[model samples]
Target: MSINLSEPIKIVFNEIEIDDYLPSIKFKIDINIKQFTHLLTYSGEIWIDCKVWDRFSKGLNEGKDTTLNDMDDIFIIEIIKNNEFIEFTWSIKRKDPEGNVMTAGYSSKITDDVYSVIRNEFINYPKWW
Candidate 1:
C-alpha cells in the first residue's frame, strides 16, 4: 500500500526474537514510505548495547542527520532534516548473480510528523534483555 508523504511514516518490527544468552535481537523491519514498502529481514545480530535506535532518536529530536545500518550492512537508513521537510533514504545491499554487489534505495521528502513517528518508534522500542 502507498503512504502519503503528509502522513507519518510507518516503521514496525516484527517476528522479534531475542537471544537467550546474547545481548542481541533478530527481527524484520517493515517500513512504508510514500509508495514504497519493504520488509527487511535481518539475519545478523543486532546488539542492544549499540544503542543505534537511541542515537536515531536523539538525532531526530535535535534535527541532525542520522544513519543506521544492520550489523551485516544488509540494510541502511539515513535521515536528514532540511528546512521544513525531512529527507529519508532507505537502502539495501545484496550480492547479485556472479557475486556482483548491488544496492537499491528509495528517497523522499516527508513531513515533521513522519520524523516524530519514527523517532518515537526508536525511543520506545521494547528492550527485552
Candidate 2:
C-alpha cells in the first residue's frame, strides 16, 4: 500500500466504555486512523466519581442510551506529526471522586496525536448525529 505524507491525518475514537459497579471503572478506548491503515487501542482503569457513574448508569437504564456509533458520534482526533513520533490525546472525560475532572487521554512518540480539532469540523459535527 502507498502512504500519502501530505494527507491531513485524523484519528477517530471509535468507541469508549466504562464498566459499572467498579470503584474505578475499567475503561477501554478504541481509535483508528481516518484515511490511513492503523488501528490504535487503549485500555486502562480510570478513577471516576461514584455519583457520576450512578447518574450515567441510571440514565442508560431509563433507555437514554448514548453508545458511540462511529458513523454518527463526533470525537476529537487530529494527528500531530513530529520528527520523533505521533503525539495525540483522547476526549474521554472522567470526574474523580473528589470532583476533579480527568481526561482519558495519552500522547507520546509511539502514539498518534488524538487531540481533537475544534475548527470548522467541530461545528459541522454534532455530538450525536
Q: Pick the candidate with the highest lDDT.
A: 1
List, residue by residue over 34-99, the lDDT tens digit for candidate 2.
Answer: 434654443333333334434433433333322221211222233344466544333555456799
Q: Which runs in model 1 stand beyond 4 Å of their true positions?
A: 1-11, 20-22, 31-49, 96-98
Weakest ten-residue segment in model 2 by summed lDDT: 1-10
Model 1, 107: alpha-carbon shift in Å?
Answer: 0.4
Taking the tens digit of each residue's C-alpha lDDT, what string does model 1 give over 1-129?
Answer: 111222344555553466566455565565554554544332222333345656665786677999877667777779987677788887778776799986666787877777776666665665554
Candidate 2 Cα lDDT to native: 0.34
Clashes of 2: 6
User: Could you tell me which residue pairs clash in candidate 2?
Assistant: 76-116, 87-113, 88-113, 88-114, 89-114, 89-115
Top candidate on TM-score is: 1
Colliding pairs, model 1:
none
